[model samples]
Target: MKQLPLPMHLPARDGFDALVVGRNDHAVAHLRGLVPGAGVAAPVYLWGDAGSGKTRLLRALAEQHQAQGERIGWFDAGTALPWTLDEGWSLVVVDRCEALDAAHQQAAFALFVEAGTQGVQWAAGGRLPPVDLPVRDDLRTRLGWGHVFALQPLAEGETRAALRREADRRGILLPDEVLAHLLTHHDRDMAHLMAVLDRLDGFSLAEKRHITVPLLKKMMAENIHDLVPNPPPAP
Candidate 1:
């Protein structure tokens, strides 16, 4: 049977400002201070467990450079490109270094060497510190050469405060009870919580009701999925 494509998600907002720093303020600050193509001596390496915002931070840096009219080459473990260094690239970002296969690892190592020689700023993220990464010895050493930051997950209180901030930004009146219920009943990751808030806002609007615990329950009972529409299949 032919497989139906998965729904396309809207790109999540990622920037230093959009990030909830939690206990990772130093890491955020380092990335914020980086000037693309400024002859940075080494790559900034970030490591954290799943949902710890490693990917988000990398993307945020890339977006910042791109906004400044710098050409960026971004690669992840799943990137299918040949991973050759482009002379025009002002910055290069590699995410999910922990998941790289043999070929991708080789490609990443070569890209790092070329980027270093050509004065291209680079950053990388992974689930483990360079010393503990399950990659080649030389590549692991390269990963550890620069500033290494271990991202810490937000505490429960921090997550709640972040949700409240988002609600305020969206001009939504989120009640304490409803917020508590969401924290108790759903995934607590910032991304998942934010998506829940988005869906709840839409559901409340559709039902012509103010957001409340009852409204949240009704929305949950109906098992409302992401309100974002799926994109058309590729030709």
Candidate 2:
């Protein structure tokens, strides 16, 4: 099992359109509705395992909200800014809520309480179900108060489909052999695969070459230092 970067830059592939929903269509729908300020009062709580596209969904929605000139507050467990519900943010997205420590959990709970009163829309995700969340009990309950959808991983062929779609979007023609090599040697998850695509796109542009197996192999060799030998445990 070869390793690539733990996380590369945000993939150019995002938004509802970029997502290849299989069993997680319902989750996608609810999130898309949130982007348009659909009248669903309850906040959305999305739960899924790592590489299940939770981060992708959250970032996509945040981007949509930003595009509409809406005030959006996006927070990840690692970089949660100080937030107060009274800030008049239209949408608040909190990812990896389960990883929040005690102080951040308190801040999140405050935000949730204010969001309820202000009717601010919320889209959040965690690795664990709300009931099983390690955060404060009230916050856990609030996480599940609204629509809770468990995002499913892509089916067998969906990964390749996503790679092809992203390649098309970037106007790069990736060979089948390169795609097969990724599926066999690297992370099959869409997040990681998209990251590789992003790197490949940049590398091709910089090196003035088309995307091919040999090019990809060279890029992988050059990026071997980005690989994580022993990744941290997921929440």
Candidate 3:
């Protein structure tokens, strides 16, 4: 197969206000939109199902923003900021933007608008588009004023490719047969797959063995064989 671009950046630490997305195709594009004229729609707003890689893309964007020497501040809204948001920061990122209750939602929206003029570019993620939001007017309009993009869930094909790519990243030689089995029988979630892969990766490294069908079988038996029925009689 041809080489694909790197699976996109993963944040080392998750600031509460920002999101961490997965290896979905939209990751880099979403990050690039942060630069207003970087050939992406401006004032980008991302929407996606829960666990659909929204946070990961947000994190990638945060990484790019930080790389360019821009300061990014995160606000969960649920947590009160000890100081005013008027502090010096070029980017203010908020996730679960919908979590703000009605009474204070307008104040939150005003902050977003204020942040923009204050040299802080704002990006937020929520399930509904700002136009569709029924929250406070200022907040809803503020959300709608920017570019709005929704993240689609990864297809099975994409998920499988992600698995293979991750295995390569860890220097684990996942047998083609074992890879096929895992992708076919297990959950179609990249997040879940990665979580389990870490365990498999560590095991393979400790044993000084490449990932093989037998090794997978043994690992699964010790841990998650119950996840996949029968598991093809264990090779």
Candidate 4:
């Protein structure tokens, strides 16, 4: 079997403008207000299902602050560094709160306390609401102490439209059949769909093939071991 090249990391389409609002307009608006001089000073906690743009929003806010040369403290459940509070930080962002282990939770709680004392603007995201998070009681309460927003997944039509727009933006001539196949055969989440599209586009370019159903299937077949549950028999 011919070895297929992996898709390189595509620049994420993250930012307030890139977000597909769907039913998350209010959440987006509130998040936008988190930037300095937006007149909204409360911390925010966002809860949603997978691929509901929680990470996107958090990253967007971080980017916005970073663009203005503000110091940012970003902590995620996967971070190897201790979640210590930095007094010089102008903004703080915490992601994947639900995945935090005992040590991370304790550190996060302390960071939260210090951030509160220093009036540092902060935001966090999790898969579950603060009330339902399986973390320490005090930390859970702190997660809910400010504005809480529930992000909604884009509807099917909305997702299709967004995909089409992305394709157009990328100058890829995405056919209907390819779009339908993606919707039916792959994960329906926007993030996953976008990643697949990115891979497909890269594959098409490397192979000098038109973006067709056959080409899509061929790419998937060549990359099956990387993409799906079962790998095809070795040639």
Candidate 5:
């Protein structure tokens, strides 16, 4: 285990279970299986669409590894790569892997390949499927080598559960009617919903108002753009 100045619990910091509710179980389970089992050399690859919980799953994995006292290096492709060949051995959890160019991908693959032997595990999430991305044959082969898991979108019921859970965690009282109104009008993506919820929490606290349908209409209408689709352009 990683002996450190502080014993950080993976579940708490990562919000492991809370952030990834509904349709996250399958991918989470598959990634956990990667750490165990006598599998072929290589890190696990989680491929999914944006807001499909790929990044959340990756964080959960990295936190778990960190709790074990292992060093974990995170590479965010949204920004430039500070990664080099030497940044191995640590549990590598790279997000936005699809954003990395071909050359960088090859370099990352080479490092991960080495890590496989040194008892270093890697986990990464990518937007592009291996077949779709402009990648070297070797890198594609390596990415495909590990267990492939797809994070599916949350169902409507799952969506409701997620909303309720988020409200509870934030200690905000969101009634069912308000939730339904938000879900009906807003984008189906959880991230957007969460943002709206955050705004609601702030506005409600500011005004000392309860979160109800009437309150959501008055407050959200002021801050949020209409979720309803604009009328079709006149012919």
Candidate 6:
């Protein structure tokens, strides 16, 4: 029942259905088969850079399975231990696999070995693919035993579509030019990009103006300026 650290402000639509698959449709399809009674195998691995939505996918899959009365254990690789693979765990999802230490690696290997007999399904995620993981050779090999997918980051057009969807959800009218500017200069990840909408909403309300490129520039400038330490007066 453990949970990974996710942004507290996640949109209400944080589920597999909301995932923007861009080029990862095959991987997403395999993930969908992990549900209980789906007759799927274990060690489904997904790797991608940070903010590529690996954690979100893991969380979404875990949540879906849990809702169906299945026992699910979710963990961040750094603190996750193999001992948690106790009895009655229908699904085990480990995120941040690149952070696992030697001890955890051995434990993960054991889990992989016993997955068939224990009736446990495995889904692990990391910043890199299995062969590139920092775990032991045996464990790394086991991680790739089943479906291994490299979740692709959103393309420019995909990011723009996501932004438009989020803006519509927030009941805000975002001009195409403003969207283009943010897409061009700002962080391209959907998670971070979507988060900007909340701040924009607040700024627009306080200033009594609709969202515009100039308004976003002003807000961003103030945010950056606030991070700077004020200079000391001449001593």
Question: lDDT by residue for model 2 over 1-235, one digit each (tens)?
Answer: 3443344344474578777888888877777777555653578888888778888888888877777887777776887457666465788888898899998898888887777677778889999989999988888888988889888888768888888888887677889998898888886667677778788887777677888888888998998656433467889
Comparing 2 with 6 on lDDT, the higher-scoring candidate is: 2
| Model 3 stretches with alpha carbons more than 4 Å out | 1-30, 36-42, 77-86, 101-107, 131-134, 206-209, 212-235
Superposed Cα deviation of residue 176, candidate 2 (Å): 0.7
Q: What is the TM-score of each candidate against the true structure?
A: 0.82, 0.86, 0.67, 0.89, 0.77, 0.79
Instruction: Pull out the clashing pairs in model 3.
Output: 20-55, 20-56, 21-55, 21-56, 21-57, 43-147, 45-147
Q: What is the C-alpha RMSD of each candidate to the true structure, in Å?
A: 6.7, 5.0, 9.0, 3.7, 8.1, 7.0
**Candidate 5 clashing pairs, residues 3+ apart or interchain:** 2-68, 2-69
Candidate 2 whole-model C-alpha lDDT, 0 to 1: 0.79
Q: Residue 24 of model 6: what lDDT?
A: 78
**For all candidates, what are the clash counts?**
0, 0, 7, 0, 2, 0
Q: Quick one: best TM-score, which candidate?
A: 4
Q: Cα deviation of 97 in candidate 2 (Å)?
A: 1.0
lDDT of 4 by residue, 1-235 (tens): 4355565535666667776789998988877777765553877999999878798888888888877777899999998856777767888888999999999999889888888888888799999999999999999999998999999988888888888888877788999988899888987777788878888888887887889999999988888766663446789
List where candidate 2 sits over 4 angstroms from the true fold. 1-13, 35-37, 227-235
lDDT of model 2 at position 232: 75
The Cα error of candidate 6 at residue 175, in Å, is 2.1
Cα deviation at 82, candidate 1, in Å, is 1.7
Q: What pairs collide in candidate 6?
A: none
| Residues forming the 10-long window of minimal summed lDDT in candidate 6 | 1-10
**Model 6, range 6-56, lDDT digits (tens) per residue?**
334335566687666788788878778788987757578899986687887
TM-score, model 6 to reference: 0.79
Q: Candidate 5: which stretches are off by over 4 Å?
A: 1-13, 19-24, 34-42, 85-89, 218-222, 225-235
Winner by TM-score between candidate 3 and candidate 1: 1
The CA lDDT at 207 in model 5 is 65
